[model samples]
Target: MTILSDIPRLLPEGMALGPALDRALAILERAGFSAVIYDYTPVPRSHDGSLITPNILEARRVPEDMLALWKSGFYQLDPVQDAALATAAPFVWSGLGKQSRVMDEVIRERHRPVLGYMHDMRFSFGVTVPIHQPRGDLATFTAIRIDAEPDFAADAAEIVPQIGVLGQIFHDVVSAGFDAETRRTHHVRLTPRERECLSLCADGLTAKEIARRIERSVPTVTLHLNAASRKLGARNRFQAVARAAHYRLIEAAPAA
Candidate 1:
């Protein structure tokens, strides 16, 4: 018997990214989901605070019409996707019963068609695992249960938390398709100096302190920080530090 936690080890070795994603969907199907949506973004947000097109998006068992409409930009308006972005934890939601998530938060008139399509298709009950990569990329794995009863979420609770490990492993497989340099650079690139500055900043050092530690001018330290911030798509140096830590470009500051 295969344990749900073993989904990663069960994945086929050396497959292409498309085939790998399909294999992941198949694995989830075996886990009892009727449908699955996998979306990955190398850059998930802009400095302007808007959704960017995901670098990779795939779905299994979604109707073509709705998938087309969603691909045409409505995917950004997905409340479930939005909920996934709000946290790194896995969760379950339903379109029925005592509404577990804020369904209408981003729902506007233009999304009505997609909503109607989902209603028509019964793609309601769902469990989602949000994978936050060490490099700051984000991916979501959603398993949808077609026409599931209101008790679906309750039943899923037994398995949902463990399912997160599946998403984590599958994301690694899908991410393997890209060139190593491309993933390392396009996702977020930093020079040794820039990375050092950000690391110091995250360690609660001021720019002047960073300059003194590195034996550089304060302006030079500021320059490296500003450049790192720009490369990281951060609004400011502090945000750059946080983003760098999130990317594991720098370790978390030891607790005081």
Candidate 2:
């Protein structure tokens, strides 16, 4: 708890991304890690579970080739990313071991080459913190402890809660500068009217009901819904509501 409490003190005065990251790395180092990677994705995946490209990636003390691979669709095969999506908790992982049935299946069925690459690079021990934001962004904090002994994973496991706190704080400070990009990505945008229409749609209202609720004509509602559908890359209004909710572009409340 004290360790996490100390992180804000270590953070930079103005919370600039570069300096804040440098300080974050220092905290990780003091905690026995040698390398750190921080990645923030505005859109992590689509409603149908396809990988979306990340918009930002930052790293220190990691290999250049590894960073290059991350940009080149390597994240699609990363088991850490898969696991992170499944749980909000932090986890300790080894590049060498048979971790779990799910991870093992991912490795055997698809991601073995990624694990092999990790083994050959000697960045074999690490912990990853999955920091999912309220507006549906994902920022992962990963720390690697190179040349770790046999018991390193256990030690890493014990400190996950502290690490999770530190990771979230770092993400909050760094994201203070990202107000301009929060609601819309380069690939998609929904108008205020479009979002309102979709939010109502997600609540299971028919087009006529939505029109009456928003005091708009049925044709106007149809246009906005269609526009949202087009922007979301959906086949139709139903798919648009689904994608919009998943992207956090609209309210996800259950239909009443």
lDDT of each: 0.71, 0.77
What would the per-residue lDDT of candidate 2 be over residues 1-256, giving only the tens digit for each residue? Answer: 1356556578744587788878888888766888988888877886667566566778888877987897787877788788877777787677876474445444445677778778887765777889987767788998888777777767776776787888888888888777656435544678889989998888878999999999999999999999888888899888888788777677756645
lDDT by residue for model 1 over 120-210, one digit each (tens)?
7887677788888766677888778888766666766677776677777767776677664434323476888998999889888999999
Could you tell me every candidate's TM-score relative to the true structure? Answer: 0.63, 0.74
Task: Give candidate 1 regions above 4 Å deviation.
Answer: 1-9, 101-116, 180-256
What TM-score does candidate 1 get on C-alpha atoms?
Answer: 0.63
Cα TM-score of candidate 2: 0.74
Off by over 4 Å in 2: 1-5, 12-14, 98-108, 134-136, 149-158, 183-231, 251-256
lDDT assessment of candidate 1: 0.71
How many backbone collisions does model 2 have?
Answer: 0
Q: List the residue pairs that clash in candidate 2.
A: none
